[model samples]
Target: MGQVREGTTWLSVIWRVCNVFMSLFFALATYVQINDPDAGMWMVGYGVPSVLCALISWKPLVSEHLAWRRVADLHVMISSSVVIMLGWRIHKEQITQIFQQEEGREFFGLLLTSMWLLLCRHSGRSAVGKLRVFTAVAITLFPFITWFYYHVNKELRSEWPSHCKTAI
Candidate 1:
């Protein structure tokens, strides 16, 4: 019983660490959007999650609050809608290399945000599951890895719009 409890505590710590990383990632995402043509929309989109994740990191049970849940739900709804629209556009246009296009990248960004919110939705009410911890680690690593890839392969971004190129 003591061993099981210790494991659970470790999982909780890992989960919070994941949230901390994600909060930083979202903040950086928000920062880079400042150069976007529609900076306000994207800034708010990324900014909300950054704040939400930071709250979770600081207080894991913050998600249980009515206001927090409401804000998260609303953001997820808006992001999901945009994701659907972007998916349709991508399908209709038959975009081959999604990472090569701005809309495609936006699609993935919103999808990531929505998925993370959903993962965190009921977290305050239960022990951090092992599966959730594993998933969080994977999700947390994805954006960083992809960003590094783009940073290293500068040629891939040669055709990016002027605004996209300006991001750090």
Candidate 2:
């Protein structure tokens, strides 16, 4: 039998952790929704990407070349920055709130796309310029797309805190 490569083993551990985090986020969202209707919707909104990430992680074929760690790092950085900015905008927002914003969700989605592009690039599996363009577009438009979706969806209004009324 072929042994698992060392890199693959480490990658598996990292992916597992990411999956666990996503799962926990999903559970928390469900719990919040059960306990408080208003907050529950916000949790549900955030949980969508978390669930997506978890599902993606489950597929070794999907996670292997995608460099999930690098994508996750970028997501954490970008999302954290947006969260901090939002917190600053609304004095009442807590540091932890940055982790729970829609911006964070979008970051993960964009990160996934970018990582896929990188995979294609490394594998020489597609036209070179295409992946670059896709990565650039995904990174550039992620925040706007997320904000647009959040604002246009009237149902998500309840997810916003009264004090943090302004868009981040």
Candidate 3:
């Protein structure tokens, strides 16, 4: 029992570390998205960590010896995948232009959906619970929040007109 507890604690620490890295990555990506639409390379900074966390978390998640951690790790994996996919889409020239042409409205919508999915994964209940409610609220307000930010950021406004529309 003691050994199991210790292992669980260690896994939890790793999970928390991954979360911290993810938060930083997101912050950096958001800054880049808002300030430097041309700096598509910045997406890799967040993508790499998100993929690494998902991969590292996979081992414990699949181990029969650590069922609880496995479930938690699965959530992390899903979250990471969502982030990676979104990042990839944003970095692609064609997709990125589509997003920019639309004034980031679609991009923000997708981001909100992904975030809500992530929140659902984190929300402790295996089934429906408060987390679901929170996800609902997030999904509902995601577009509005994104639009608000888009309007507030001058860089977003100025760059849209001159950005390339060529599909990747």
Candidate 4:
């Protein structure tokens, strides 16, 4: 529904600040990655869109209009997927030392930022706001769970099996 129409609120301001901060950080990261001679065009492909989306997200908050908010939501959603794919690619590239790698941080950054934006966007409804908050809290725990699982199943994860294995 359109109940969560764009209107400047504390939540919107917070989300806007978050988006601006993330955009700055991602922009800096992209710059650093681009400077690396070994870094290929793929980083640019992901980085450009990510930074653009992050930057644009602020427009809705600044404009404080329903249409702009919707636009920002759409862009954030797109950027979230892009960053997820980018993060996965980085994680895969570090398969040799996944345990030692911090490659998935970007995905977490994107995900958390997106969650906050979504939460703020829906803050008009108490039920939806609570749900978003709950979802954010739950998702925040995933990294720790993943780390624990990785440590416990390190051996299994190290070897990518090609055949189906019985799970009895």
Candidate 5:
């Protein structure tokens, strides 16, 4: 029983740390959208998750609030819809390197936000599982690594819209 408690405590710490990282990533995502034509829409898309994740990191129990769940759910629904549309667009365009194009990037941003929100749902009520911690680490790392890859390899972003080139 004591061992289980210790493990849960450790995993909860990891969950909080990962949420902090993800919040920052989403916040950065929101900032970079300043140059986008549809900046406001994209900003809200990323901003909500940024704030929610921040709340979770600050107080894990925030996830248990009805208001928080409703807001997160609404965002998830909207993000999922956008993800489907973006997926179709990517498919139609035959976009193999999704990070290179604007819509491709948008697709990923929304998808990540949606996924993380779903993962966080009801997480405050119990100890975060090992799988959730591992997933949180991956989710926290992916965007930053992908962004760095694009930032370093300018050639990969050669075909990107002018606005997309300015932020990173």
Candidate 6:
């Protein structure tokens, strides 16, 4: 019992330390994106919410004084959704504009980045829970990713989407 308490206390301290850095990281990202003219509305719009989510989810005082796990889960889900939507909207532009990546490397990086977007979520101890999270993410993201790839293909049908219409 004492050992469990000690370990939990140590983990809480570590979480607090991590919270500080994560808050800073998200804040910086938010500020930079908001100030960047070329980042597009989608990116800039989600920036503030992202920082708020990060700060609220990880702040020890907020967590301790409130329904910590519920709040954390809610914020994490919102932040992850924002990230995935932004990625879906701009994945093509990013893949094309980024530093020289030989051929297939860009898509590989995109896949990895998409997978890593939800690492903050403590997806529970059960395999079913973890699998559910991954499955949900995949289901939500796969369509956009597939659309992106298909649209990018040189031989994709010209009838796919009209240039006059935005993808929404």
Model 2 regions lying over 4 Å from their true place:
1-4, 60-85, 91-168
- lDDT string for model 5 (1-168, tens) is 999999999999999999999999999989989999999999999999999999999999999999999999999999999999999999998989877777888898899999999999999988789999999898888888887887888898898899888886
State the number of backbone clashes in model 2: 1
- The candidate that wins on lDDT is 1
lDDT tens readout by residue for model 2, 1-168: 234465445545554444455455444434544433355445544454455456554653443445655554554555456555544554454335442464444345434433433332232232224334444345435444655686687666566544333423
Q: TM-score, each model?
A: 0.98, 0.36, 0.31, 0.39, 0.95, 0.38
For residues 77-119, could you state the per-residue lDDT of candidate 1 as single tens digits? Answer: 9999999999999999999889899989999999999999999
In terms of TM-score, how similar is model 3 to the real structure? 0.31
Task: Arrange candidates, best TM-score first.
Answer: 1, 5, 4, 6, 2, 3
Could you say which candidate leads in TM-score?
A: 1
Q: 1-168, model 6: which lDDT tens digit per residue?
A: 897777655555444444344444434434444334344543433343345335534653443333545645554555456556545645755655322232232233333323323343442222223344345445435434654675576354343233212332
- Taken over the whole model, the C-alpha lDDT of each candidate is 0.95, 0.46, 0.45, 0.49, 0.93, 0.42
Model 3, span 115-154: residue lDDT tens: 5334434323222333344444444444445555865775
For candidate 2, the per-residue lDDT at 154 reads 61
- Segments of candidate 6 deviating more than 4 angstroms: 38-61, 64-168
Clashing pairs in 6: none
Rank by lDDT (best first): 1, 5, 4, 2, 3, 6
After aligning candidate 1 to the native by TM-score, how far in Å is the CA of 42 from where it should be?
A: 0.1
Candidate 3 yields a Cα-based lDDT of 0.45
User: In candidate 5, what residue range of length 10 has the lowest lDDT sum?
Assistant: 97-106
Model 4 Cα displacement at 28 (Å)? 0.9
User: Against the correct fold, how does model 4 do in TM-score?
Assistant: 0.39
For model 3, what is the error of residue 168's alpha carbon versus the real structure, in angstroms, after optimal superposition? Answer: 22
